[model samples]
Target: MPTAASSPKNEITIVGAGIVGLATAFHLLAEGHRVRLVERGGVAEGASFGNAGAFAFSDILPLASPGMLRKAPKWLIDPLGPLTIPPRYLPQITPWLVRFWRASLPDRYRASLTAQGGLMRFAATATQAMVAQADLAGHIRADGNLQLYESEAELAAAQPGWEARAREGIEFEHVRGERLAELQPGLSPRFVAGTFTPHWQTVSDPYHYALALFRAVMARGAGLVHGEVTGVEADSRGVRLRLADGQVLNAGRVVIAGGAWSRPLARSLGDFIPLETERGYNTTLPPGAFDLRRQLTFGGHGFVVTPLSTGIRVGGAVELGGLKAPPNFRRADAMLTKAARFLPGLRTEGGRQWMGFRPSLPDSLPVIGRSTASPAAFYAFGHGHLGLTQSAATGKLIADLVAGRRPPIPLEPFRPDRF
Candidate 1:
């Protein structure tokens, strides 16, 4: 058993200043530990800044499910489809794809749900706490989210997912006609059916939320280093970080939370993980592009329309095009086209497109425990689309682990060595 006496407060260095890294720094600083946060770019520059801004606690289903393999061929062939895999990248990703297939088995799928549910159970409360602490309550809305279907058959086809959610005790209400229109006015009449989950939340500005957290952590005495981390070396006594500019920094402990760039650092520390990048694209319209009271998902279209402080953001779709691939803004345009079809009256012109990489693993779970290679090193990356949703809880759990206190949730499922 781990004890507090065995793990005293020490100077800590955290790599990556995205949502996850900043959240970890916040927790550690609150615990009276000295913390230094390192980032290649500015804060919230990656997926943390451009996400859909949804705190989707009810979306516990993994991306790889039983029926996905059957649809893979079609999705792979359709360049503009919701899921795309570049033909050139197939050989490089085959091993990871194989693991993804095995993870989609009935048994493994259920286990993933259980493990994901355990982490999401803390999502709502933790997010609320962080928002309140950072005085970012103005940037969040609790109006819930809607998943719309165009026809009865389409709604019927989603029964299995609803059943799974029900088994997990997720609350939802089915609506149509007047009820749907009452909840979301001006919606197209083509959306004949909808499912609403009131427990879901949204951030009016994801980048602002991250920046608020970063400022709060800094106020609490955490240092920020603006440099690209080239390598990391860890020993029993401490960890050393190498920068691209030939600067070296050292700390008594280190946490590697560098989203898509984490693999190289982890490999240097002797822990190999099957981390891949899920290239995601989004388009942001002007402030008055559409009127939306809450977040809306066009299920058939595989995209979400969220009301943000800046404007309306339509984001979704997965592309396995690695980190070095050029941005495919065409994917963003396709989403805008779909969004226009979903809401015929909405303006789709003058929109800004963006592409960001989401760190992902075969099992759809983040690595969130001590690295076997070094006791002073910890892992907290590969969160897929749930990075913003699980950031606060992950931060608290990591703080507990570093302090030698038992985590609120089991770490076995998210262990770094599980791969």
Candidate 2:
């Protein structure tokens, strides 16, 4: 019997209702294509719901860097440190770690920086245009980010990275003493130097921003399907999406934007990507928790304090535990304790803790090109910590491909089978 694929193949289905998937739907809808968003759970309830809501366009540095490699030994030793690997999952994650180490090689790291910077440049433009076109300007905040350093040594150590950002045309000022105090008051005196990016921006709340995008797409005639996609088969006719309970949907083209859960789907389609889950934990305090003037980055400790409309969010750390592990609220507690000490007046009570997976690639670049198995299918996950920051650009690029137009940037760096 014929299914929905028999229809003129006008509708495009995007898997995952997170920011990436939703943004893709938005762009597809704008291109005059019918759109359907399929999700396994509530929209934005994954990493999108709990992230520190920074636009972070200036953050083009890849996580798999020599700097991070140097710090990994100490970080991995602490069970609740910024980076960790659960004992039981060590064997499973070893392969990904080995790839990560390769990516950290000096030459590869430089290439990644160039690729990331290019994507970020496109992302900044794409985000502005999308926000304006979607009428989401009200939800954005232009407050700068203050990245604090503990001592002169730490600041000096980070100078090269700062120079890299400057070369990329990202504006920032190195500040201290009175200037630093004015930018962010109540900061612990222990922080002797800081880099302030005056143009840095953030959303009022990440989940709310996602909600607004969801509303924008829906208002433009986008639809949603609630199901777990278990199988995908793309043929000359179109693509068929299968849910676990045997329900099937058909679309002319599909974008696999399912975040951390996307690897298996890509594998089923014969694209073996080395995707890993960067499990990040965070704690959100109730409103009035602190007089945070702007986002505060304690980069050395692997966290940031974001002032959200809903609350004060404090968290950032990578737990290399796999998808099925139970929540370790201890990570949240540790970040909160550190936050209180740094802010000197933070109210850590009435805070909510969260854990979520960031789908990551070894080279810190997302897979944003055609699937090796099917031209009708595309891969768009693995943005890692920058998923939200890069969502609109991914959307625009993917939409261009679906429309049979040339993408604005080279997609070779983000191809699926690169690993």
Candidate 3:
């Protein structure tokens, strides 16, 4: 059993200043809890800064599905494919890959789907409430997502997943011919079909959205600390966070939302979670880059082109390279080349390329429970690509746990000791 936060005015210290941390701080503050946000870099400076910006409430499927496995082999061969594991990292990644394979089994996949479905449902509701509460509606766009396909075979191959989404009450439309062009003009004739989800929404820009959330937290009396956290220790006295500068701050409780750089902190606290990094790549072009409409997904190719309030951002792929390796910008180049072909009028020049780490678990679910080591410590990391999408829900759930109130959803599927 975990120790209760004890009072409505509990002082909580959260590590990591990304979307997850900001959102967690927002919820805690809503309950009149005092919060101090600690970060090694600027807010939303990591993966949260450059994601596809979709709310993705409809993306309930786990990435470890059989479909992903079928695509992985082909993607692995091509260094710049939608998914790639660096040759040197293969040995280290094998164990995680084995777990991923088991997760893709029919029985396991169904279990994960049920849990993910519940989270997505709660997430959609929680995100709306958060946005409304913070009055950040100006940053949101209701423009739906259009996933493009090149051939009938490709479209046919996607039917099962669509059917699964339908079973979960997600609304979507399958369109071909002129309707495709109407949804997104200037597309190459090669794209024969698409599926549009009308409820999907996006932020004008992910980083700005997070910054808005941070400001909301601050307005409610949250403090911001900038430094690398080297260690976390807890005892009956309280939880203490040690920074690289040899500073220590004690708080009523601590929540770790440290994205891809969180594994070491968790390990030091006695939990051995198999957290890995998916090095995602992208490029942001100038504002007038092809007048991109809503986000466009080239699923078969493994990337997306999104229109942000800042610019037209292009490309995203899973590169299972570790944290230490230098980024291969050619991956960005590859996706850009493909985007130009799909959107005939896309201007590829004058773009800024970026690479960031997305922390992941083999089961494709985040850890959102108290640390098995101590009741005073909690976890809210390993969200992978869905970190931005699920941030608000994770925040609410973590707040519920700290307050000693039963979470709206079961935590069994996201327990810290599950492994």
Candidate 4:
């Protein structure tokens, strides 16, 4: 089953140890291949650690979808708004944002949504399979996710969108007033109507899931290195990873899944990936009287509040801050304050904040295929806010690409050089 030639000792080096990298290593090991996963920091301790944890099935809209460009200026003005661009970093990322604005055209938007939707559907199944194989069912919760809206007018206006999604086979049911209370008694009565995507799921802790994957892969005898890969050297025979410490590790193929920090690593291999970090924030509260049964997304606030087994967790926002900058925890605190408006009983004062990067491209679709620049290198980053939803499927696609097998989905839409 191994694809690394006839020698079992051949190393298949993976450049990042986030969800995508670890999952790819898992799949490769499943196929009897030896792998070495190298991370810049601790495993899964990057952006993958503090995600909102929603296993979204209908998060079909791309970040560059229509109607976002006009709202950008306003969203940037309001500090409490869903999207923000820090004044200091504007000069550096403006070009990328301009390209992103252009990609928001209807044609590109539709294509991105379709491709991401298909990948997300396949990812849901792959997630189930991998989790079951690792026996991590305890960390997974099957409670369907609810998207709440306070205004009936807004809900009515969004009908066409929901109907289109339904036509695409995304299961959902409408909930209003009393029905909303019946389904989630903790929600504020101000939320007049909402939609419940019964197919969606959530993980109690993303770190726990990553830990599970790490343990499973290590148990199967894969190797892991704690270092940053500064460069990737590719040739006809294979690829070699150049680490920060100047050590080289050879592999038949290399996967770039370094999240927001992927652009530079990708560039070192001669690919120009116009990627930016959509920095997201999260707040974790100590256990209190507030208990929630399902994941909650406030349409008005543009954030999600999920009931973590430890305490309540709130995370959202798209700040154009680079990956290495210090995190502004105020955004996460703002999320808690915003959550209080939706659930009157929810406390806003007693939680700590965290921030991490979400790798984003001008177009919402991620780069998930072989590179035209380098035959032995592969690209799988840029999932935006849907990294968790897209990770598993991306891994399977990478495995199929390396094995030279037909991918489950067409690869043209996600070509690395579409720029």
TM-score for all models, in order of appearance: 0.96, 0.98, 0.97, 0.95
Worst 10-residue lDDT window for candidate 3 reads 1-10
How does residue 211 of candidate 2 score in lDDT?
96
Worst 10 residues of 2 by lDDT: 1-10
What would the per-residue lDDT of candidate 2 be over residues 1-419, giving only the tens digit for each residue?
55554463657889999999999999998988888899999999988999999899999999999999999999988899899899999999999999999999999999899989899999999999999999999989998899999999999999999999989999999999999999998899999999999878999999999999999999998889899999888989889998998998878888999999999998887789999899998999999999999999999999999999999999999998989999898998999999999999898899999998999988889999999999999888999999999999999999988888999888888999888
lDDT of 4 by residue, 1-419 (tens): 75646442366778888888888888888887778888889999888898888888788777686657755677777886788888889899989988887778888777777887788778888888888887778988888888888788878867867876876789999898777887688777778889988888888788888888899999998888888888887888788788889887777778888888888888888899898888889887776636677888875566898776666788798888776678877787777777887788876666777888888888877899887778778888988888887787888888888888999888887898888
Candidate 2 vs. true structure, TM-score: 0.98
In model 4, which regions exceed 4 Å deviation? Answer: 1-9
- The per-model lDDT (C-alpha) reads 0.88, 0.92, 0.90, 0.82
Cα deviation of 292 in candidate 2 (Å)?
Answer: 0.3
Q: Residue-wise lDDT of candidate 3 within 1-419, one digit each (tens)?
A: 43455442256999999999999999999988889999998889989999989898888889989999898888888988899988899898888899989999988998898899899999999999999999889999998999999999999999999998899899999999888889998899999999999989999999899999988988998898889999988878778888999998778789999999988889877788889999999999999989677999898998988999999999789998888999999999999999988888788899999999999999999999999998999999999989988999999999999999999988899998887
Q: Pick the candidate with the highest TM-score.
A: 2
Q: What is the lDDT of residue 63 in candidate 1?
A: 77
**lDDT measured at residue 6 in model 2 versus the true structure, 0 to 100:** 40
Question: What overall lDDT, based on C-alpha atoms, would model 1 receive against the true structure?
Answer: 0.88
Instruction: Give the higher-TM-score candidate: 3 or 4.
Output: 3
C-alpha RMSD of each candidate structure in angstroms: 3.4, 1.6, 2.9, 2.4
